[model samples]
Target: MHLLAHRGYHAKLPENTLTAFASAVEVGFEGIETDVRVSADNEPVLFHDRVAPNGVAVAALTRKQLSEVCGYTVPTLTEALDALPGIWWNIEIKTPAAASLALPILSDYDSSHRLLVTSFRHDVVLAAAEMLASDCGLLNAHRPAALSTLLHAALPHPNLRTLVWDCEIVDPDILRQANALGFRNAVYGAKTLYEHQLMQELGVHTLITDYPQYVGLLPG
Candidate 1:
């Protein structure tokens, strides 16, 4: 199983900032997940919230203007790929526009071995798959449901290899069902050592957590 830094280890620095991403690399995390949104000028930027820290909506500012006002510049998809070379990325498209913007950039980057495009929105996932085709893997974030329902929903997508479930949805049965479906399922919000052990025992491929270090990825 792998330990993935959530929003670039936000507990240690500002979430989705380049600084935070760099810190995750420094700590030797193999993968990092971050949210992407398009600015008013149509440049893709790494930011989770529609509203900025100052209560200004991100859509209200151009990418360049957003950088001047927000202290951190809005980074393009290209910029992020350049900044974090040689690391696997889980880039979540936050909206349809972002999905559209990301597909081309991802293709241009064309590092299918190093990037997985994911989205909570089903439409975004479909669009990304259509655009990216076989170049990148698609990860689906789904709420926990009955084993039968999960099996039904997942059976059609042969290319879908990763699933992220809410922390509340994790149970032995669910984990078993996901494993049966050939998915590398992960539970979010793992706050304790016991939870980490439970996930590891269940064969979860990754743990999305604020404290990646506490999950005991590094040798004692």
Candidate 2:
């Protein structure tokens, strides 16, 4: 199983910062998982929430403005791609606007099969599917409504490759079915070594965690 650094070694560093991402790569994580939100100019910024410093919405600020506000030097998605290389990337589109914004930037790179784009909004995945060769994940799909949407994506879209799920609420049969339909699975929040080992035994492909070094697995 591969270990993904959740928001790039956020166990100690600021989430989604370039420093955090570089540290994860240095620690030999197989992949980096980061969030994307759009600025007023439609540039994709690496941040997890709509709200920025002083209650300003991330979408309302330009790149120059949002950079100094996100608690770290908030890099644009393109900047991140430039900074980190030779590893898989799980890029989560946090808003519908970002779904559109990220695709254009992603298309500029010959990203190979290393990019897995995801979002809570299935429309975002659908939007990505229309353009990129990258695999897509059905994000946060353990809830009832989201699971319904995930089931729909699995039926016809072979590129919808993973389900980013809450580990505790998973149904093995559902995962079996999803796998049967060509979807791999990745679980979030595996806090302990035992839990990580359990996922390894479960044959899970990826586990998103804060402490990749503590999981007792070799780097992929």
Candidate 3:
């Protein structure tokens, strides 16, 4: 299974920052997952929360102000990708407006670098699939009632080849169905050794985890 450092191995370092991303690389992770939100200046920056610690919306602050508010430098999406060009990125767009801003930046990126642009917003995923050369994935926490129908609907988009599901809802049958429908299954929220073993047994394509050090030690 491919292991992606969720929020860039932030067990010690602050998450969604350049330092964390570099640390993820230092530990030999080729993939990193991070969230994207647009600042008030319309710049796509790497940040996870809807609101800052100072009780302000992320969209209400400029990138520089966000860094000050958060007490650490908040790297713009471009800054993060430019600094770490080799690693595969799982860019989770946090809002539809963020998608509008981030897509243009992502379009200018080197196409040779692998990217799996995903979002809980299906609309954003569809929009990204149409515009980007990179692979786009639909992220879902809860299982949809018509799983096959959801797969069939997404299969038409050539770039939409993966489904990022919450590990709580993933099982062998889920993987089998996703595989049968031409979807590679990626799961997040797995935090234990048993869960890691279960993902390997399920034949998951990717495992987004918080503890890469431990997960990486598991036999591939």
Q: In every candidate, how many clashes are there?
A: 0, 0, 0
Ranked by lDDT, the better of candidates 1 and 2 is 2
Clashing pairs in 3: none
Superior by TM-score: candidate 1 or candidate 3: 3
Q: Which ten residues in a row have the lowest lDDT in candidate 3?
A: 211-220
What TM-score would every model get versus the actual structure?
Answer: 0.86, 0.88, 0.96
Q: Kindly indicate the candidate among 1 and 2 with the higher TM-score.
A: 2
Write the residue-wise lDDT of candidate 2 on 1-220 in tens digits.
Answer: 8888888977788889889999898887888999999888878889887888769998888877887665567888988888876788889988877877788888776464378888889788877876777788777745563445557755566677788877787656666766776779888878777777777777778888887667556323
After superposition, candidate 2 runs with Cα above 4 Å error: 110-113, 141-149, 217-220
Model 3: per-residue lDDT, tens digit, 1-220? 8989999978888999999999998997878999999899988989999999999999999999999998999998988888999889999999999998888888888386789999999889998989988999999989877787667657779989999989998777777878987889999998788888788878899988888766657785
Off by over 4 Å in 3: none
Q: Could you give candidate 1's per-residue lDDT for residues 166-197 as a string of tens digits?
A: 66656777677767767667667777777777
- lDDT, candidate 3, residue 113? 71
lDDT of 2 at 90: 89
lDDT of 3 at 138: 93
